[model samples]
Target: MRLLQVVLAAVFIIFQVLPAATRAFNFERPCYLRGGICLKQGTPDCEPFRGPCRAFTVCCKVKGLWGRAAAEKP
Candidate 1:
């Protein structure tokens, strides 16, 4: 019984607690729509801009949808 408890506790710490502690949290900034562009609905498009969405700025689309855009290199 004691061995089982130790094994379970070790597994929990190694698989759960350790990963959580060492994981890096990515707080992505919300994308912003550029002005002067009309937004549509249905189907997500992140064209004209490509790749992962930029920090704090959203990908622009004719339709308002979630899509990835290019992240500027530092």
Candidate 2:
């Protein structure tokens, strides 16, 4: 039990110590968007953007419609 507790603590500390920017996923930011399409201070096209959504968006979209990451050829 102590060994399991230690392992869990280590994992938690490692995740907590990661940089904030690395931990967050912003869809509007180009770096996060990568080669994907994003609104450039304007509305994006109604057609779904063909690339990775932000990490948070990924979770939400994944729960519903088929997301780009799932559709991409592996």
Candidate 3:
């Protein structure tokens, strides 16, 4: 009765408010390095190998810094 009503109200409010409050985030992964240089983008040389990963993922190599690809698009 009253409990059911409250639960329904809560669920309704969550459904209405949750999407507006949520935000998109980028995921980061570890990049592999070779001979003082980080591998180029789209290189399948990630150590502890993660295979056939998501399309948004890339091997980031900047100068001598190496890191996993970050979310570039939603």
Candidate 4:
């Protein structure tokens, strides 16, 4: 129907007009400012950061030096 077409067009326009969420380097929030890395949930031995981060990602503590040197057992 013509009404359905109009509704669909409006919905498409609204989505296109909005800013898309992406993996861009985020420096404005407290997470990036405090050196938080948004790694996927449950990365082995990574400490969880209690700050806002990207969707489906957990802000993790920086595993510098010794932490990175350790090899994963697979």
Candidate 5:
């Protein structure tokens, strides 16, 4: 149980610290450049891609889309 608690705590710390690290290094820019979005974990259809998206985030694609769509949202 202690080991599990320690692991959970470490994960929490990584989530907390990663955002600061990203701000310091501008790591999020690269993810944007790659057409990936960083979303909080458990968002639907989130498939992992390489990014600095902290421990609680998942780097996901915009469903095979690039640029704006011709169809308008009604």
Candidate 6:
């Protein structure tokens, strides 16, 4: 019974930690662009449309540069 409890505890911890580990990273704020220029208060292009505009590129979190998409809203 004690071993089972320990296993359950480990599983629970893993479940909690896994999500944090897999969390997405945001690279840039959602913005709109036109004619190859970024617009303020605009939307970005991506799979799920969160706002109006579209994303410029696949915004990914870079090491020295910016980060990737943080998370996608359902």
The Cα local distance difference test for each model comes to 0.41, 0.41, 0.44, 0.51, 0.55, 0.40
| Model 2 ranges with Cα > 4 A deviation | 20-74
The TM-score of predicted model 6 comes to: 0.34
* Candidate 6 lDDT over residue span 1-74, tens digit each: 99999999999999988877655432233433221222222234323323233443322222233422332221
Which candidate number would show the highest TM-score if scored against the true structure?
A: 5
Candidate 1 — what's its lDDT? 0.41
When superposed on Cα atoms, how far off is each prediction in RMSD? 9.5, 12.2, 10.0, 7.9, 11.8, 11.2
Pick out the ten consecutive residues of candidate 5 with the lowest summed lDDT. Answer: 65-74
Score candidate 4 by TM-score against the native: 0.34
* Model 3 C-alpha RMSD to native: 10.0
TM-score of each: 0.26, 0.27, 0.32, 0.34, 0.36, 0.34
User: What local lDDT does model 6 show for residue 8?
Assistant: 100
Task: Identify the runs in model 5 with alpha carbons over 4 angstroms from their true place.
Answer: 27-74
For model 1, residues 20-74, the per-residue Cα lDDT tens digits are: 6544332222345433122221224433332234343343423344444332222
lDDT of 5 by residue, 1-74 (tens): 99999999999999999999877765342344255666556644544433556666655555445432121111
Per-residue accuracy of model 2 over 1-74 as CA lDDT, tens digit each: 99999999999988887766454544333333334333222222323433454432321112235433322211
Measured by TM-score, how close is model 1 to the native structure?
A: 0.26
Scored against the true structure, residue 50 in model 5 reaches a CA lDDT of 36
Question: Residue by residue across 1-74, what tens digits does model 4's lDDT show?
Answer: 99999999999987776545332333333443255455545667654434446575555444577655222111
Ranking by TM-score: 5, 4, 6, 3, 2, 1
Better of 3 and 6 by lDDT: 3
Error of 4 at 29 (Å): 6.6
Candidate 3 off by > 4 Å:
23-74
lDDT score for residue 5 of model 1? 100
